[model samples]
Target: MTTEQDSRASDAVQLAETTTQPSSVVARTSTWSVWALFCLSVGALALTALRGTQWIVSDILIVDGLTAVMWVVVTFFSGIVHSYSRRYMAGDRDIERFYARVFGFTLVVMTMTAANHVALLAAAWLAMGLLMAGLIGHVRDWEQAQAAATLARRYFLASSALLAGSLSLLAWATGTTSISGILAQADEISTSVALVAVSAIVLAALIQSALFPFHNWLLSSMTAPTPASALMHAGFVNAGGILLTRFAPVVTLEVAVMSAVVLIGAVSALLGQAMGLVQPNVKRKLGSSTIAQMGFMIMQCGLGFFAAAIAHLILHGFYKAYLFLSAGASVEQTVPKDAKSTDTGVSSVAIGAVTAVGAGVVFATLTGKSLLAFDSGTILVLVVVLTTLTATRDILRRAVLPATLRVAAVPIVVLSAITGYALLYNAISTALSGVPMTDAPTELTAAHFLALALFVVAYLATEFGWHRSSTRLYVFLLNRSQPDSSTVLTTKAEYNDV
Candidate 1:
C-alpha cells in the first residue's frame, strides 16, 4: 500500500479505539445532568403553555413564553451534544474538564435567557463567552488551538462590553434596571440615547452572530472539538436573535436603525453564502453556513418578525448539530467517475423552481398576508421559497431514482418543509405573544427593497457561475473568509501534538 493509504488506515484504527472506550465517570454524570435539565425544561414549557402565564422574581429573573421555549431548545440541544461527546471524546485526558465546562456554559446561557436584571444578563453573557473560549482551546498542547481561543475570546469580550454599555445606557435613560420596565418606558427615552443604545445593540448582535466583518472569530475557531463547535453553532450564536427579540421595542423605534440592520444582514447573508461555496474544509464550510444562517435570523429580527427569527434559529440549531456530528462520515466517499449523469436537466430545475414558488404563494395566502404588500412576513416567505427551490433542485440533481419518482418528490418535500415551518412559526408566535413588537409587521422602505434586490442579484450571480468569472471577486471573498494567521499551522511539526 502507498504511504498515504497506510497513514489513513493507522489513523482510522486509532479513532476506532478512542471512540469505543467506556465513558469516564464525569462524562456519564454530565450526560445525566443534561438530560435531566432537558426533561425539566420540557415540563416547564408545558406548564407555561397550559397556564398561559408569565412569572418574575424580585425583578431579577423572568419566566415567560420566551424563557420557557429557550430553556427547552437549549437543554434539548445540550443533552444531545453531551450524549454525542460521550463517545466522541471518550478517552481524552481532559474529558472531565470538557464536560464540566460544557455544563457550566449551558447553565450560564439558560440563565442569560431568563435574566430580568441588566447586570445578571450581562454577567451571564460574559461568562458564556469565556466558557466557549475555554472549549475552543480544550487541547492545551496545541498552539493553534490557543490562538483560536484567544481570538474568539476577544470577539466575545467586545460583544459583552457592547451589550453591557447598551443595557446601562438604556437603564439610565429609563431609570429602570429591569428589562421589561426599561422596554415599557422606551418611549420616554431621548432620541439620541435611544439611537445610540440600539446602535450598540445592533453591533453586539452582529458580532455575536459572526456577521461579515465579525465572522473571522468563528472561522478561526475550527480548532475547537466537534462537539464544542456543534454547541456553539447550535445555541451560542442564536443568542443574537434572542437579544434582538428581547430588545425589539427599542429596535423598532428608529426607522433608519431597522433599515441599517436589514442592510447589514442582507450583505452578510450573501457574502457568507458566497464564501461557503469556496471553503475546502468541511468544518469551516459549516462555520460559513452558520454565519449565513445567523444573518438570516438577524434579518428576520430587523424585518420585525421576531417569532420567525426564533423559529429559524431553533431549526438551524438542530440541522447544524446533526451536520457537525455526522461530518466525519461525509468524507468516506471518493469522487465519482460518472458524475455527468447526476447533472440536473433544465426541465427538472424549472419544475423545482415552480414548485417552490407555488409553495410560497400558498404560505403567504395561509398566513393572510399579501405577497406584494412588502411586509416583514414576505421576507420570511421569500427566504423559504428560495431555500425550498435550492433543496428541491439539488434533490432532483442527485437522486438516482426513475424520472417519474424524481419529479414527484419535489412537491412532497416542498409541502412538508413549508408545513413544518408554518407550524414552528405559529408556535413561536404564540410563545412570544406577550413580548412587545415581536410580530409587528412594518411597512417596507425603499432601502428594504434595495437590499432584497441585492440579495436576489447576488444569489443569481453565485448560482450561475457569473461570480466565478471574476478572479478578483473570488480572491477577495477567499481572503475575507480565512481565519487568523496565528491560528493556522505553518509546519507539520506544529500538528504533531494534535
Candidate 2:
C-alpha cells in the first residue's frame, strides 16, 4: 500500500476508536465523580439516620431506618467498586458503557430501597436486573458471555415478574399503592391473598438471590469481569434479603409460610455448601459460597429476625467484594505449597466446641437474647455457635501454631469475632428499629427444630466427608452445581476477537 493510503487508514481507525470509547482522562473523571457521589450519599444518609429523620412522600418515597441503612451500605459498596473498576477495567473498548451501566444500576438499586410506590419499586427492580445482565455480557463479542447474560436475564425477568405481581396483589387487596400502607394493613388482608402474594415474593427473592433450584445464573455469571462480579455478589444478591426484610410484616403473618421459608433456606444453604466443596475454580467456589451465604441470610429472615439478615448481608457484601477484587492473587503460583493435614484431634474439637458455645453466649448477652429460650432467638444462637465452632476448627487446624497455642487461640479468636459481630448486629438492629417485625422472634415449632437438625447434619456431613459416602448424593450435588452448558468454555478456539 502507498504511504498516504496507509496513513489515511490509520487516521480513520483512530477516529472510530475515539468516537466509540471515552478518553482515559474522561473515563477516570467519570469514575471519580460516581465514587464521590456515592460517598456524599453515604454521609447524607448517616446524618439523616443520626437526626432520626423519617421522611415520607405518600406512595412515592420513604426515608426511614431501612432506607437509610440500605442506602449507606449500597452506596459505600458501589463507591468501592467504582474506584476499583477505574483501574481494573482500563483499556477496555467499552469502558464508558460499563461505567454508565454500573452508575445506572447503583442509582436504580438505591431508588428501589427507598421506593414507597409499588410501581416505582417494580420498575426499579426490572431496570436493575437489565443493567446487571448488560454488565454480565459486557464482552458482547464473546459467545459464552452472551449466553451467560441471556441465561441470567431470564432469571432476573422472572423474579421481576413475580415481584410485580405480588406487589400488585398487595396493592389491590389493601387498596393502597404504598408499600408502607399495604404492610400496615397486612393483618386485614384475606389469608388466600396474603398467601399468594407472599409466596410470589418468596419465589422472587429466591430467584434474585440465586438460591437453589434457581442458582445456575450466579454460577454462569462468571463471564462478567471481576469488578462487575464483585458488585453483583456484594450488592445485587443481597437484594433478596432486603426484599424480604422490607416485607417482614406481611411475611410474619403466616406460620406455614415461614416454615416453608425456613425449609427452603436450609436445603439451599446445605446444597450450596456441598456444591462449593467440589468446585476447583476460585470464582465458582466464591459463587457457591455466596449461594450458601444468601441461603443463610434468607434463613435468618425466615427465623423472624430481618435485622439480623440485614446485618449478615452487609457483612457478607464487604467480605465477598474483597474476595472478588483480590481473586487474581489466589491464582498466583509463586511456589507450590503442601496441603495442610486435616487430622483434627479430639482435643481440638472439644476446645472448639467449648469456645464456640462461649462466644454464642457472649453474643446473646450483648444482644439481649437468651440462649436457653425456646424461641427463634435460641435457634439463631445455636446457628451462631455452630458457625463459630466451624470457624474455630478451621483456624486451629490451619494455623501453624503449637498445640498449646492453638488451644489458647480458640477462645481469643472466636470471642473476638463474636464480639465484633454482636456490636455490628446491635448497630444494624438499631438502624432498622423503624422496620416492622425486625426482631419478631417466634416460638420453636416442630418445623423449626427439624430444619435445625437438617442444618446440623449437613454441616457435619460436609466436614466429615460423609456426603461423599453416597455416590448418588455426590453426583447429584456435582451435577446440580454446574452452570448452564452454553456459558461454559470448552476450548480457546471459541474466542472471536472484535
Candidate 1 at 102: error in angstroms? 0.2
The TM-scores of all predictions, comma-separated, are: 0.93, 0.92
- lDDT tens digits by residue: candidate 1, 198-219: 9999999899889978999999
Candidate 2 lDDT by residue in tens digits, 251-316: 888888888888888888878888887777899999999999999999988989888899989999
TM-score of model 1 relative to the true fold? Answer: 0.93
Model 2, global lDDT: 0.87
Error of 2 at 450 (Å): 1.6
- Residue-pair clashes per prediction, in order, are 0, 0
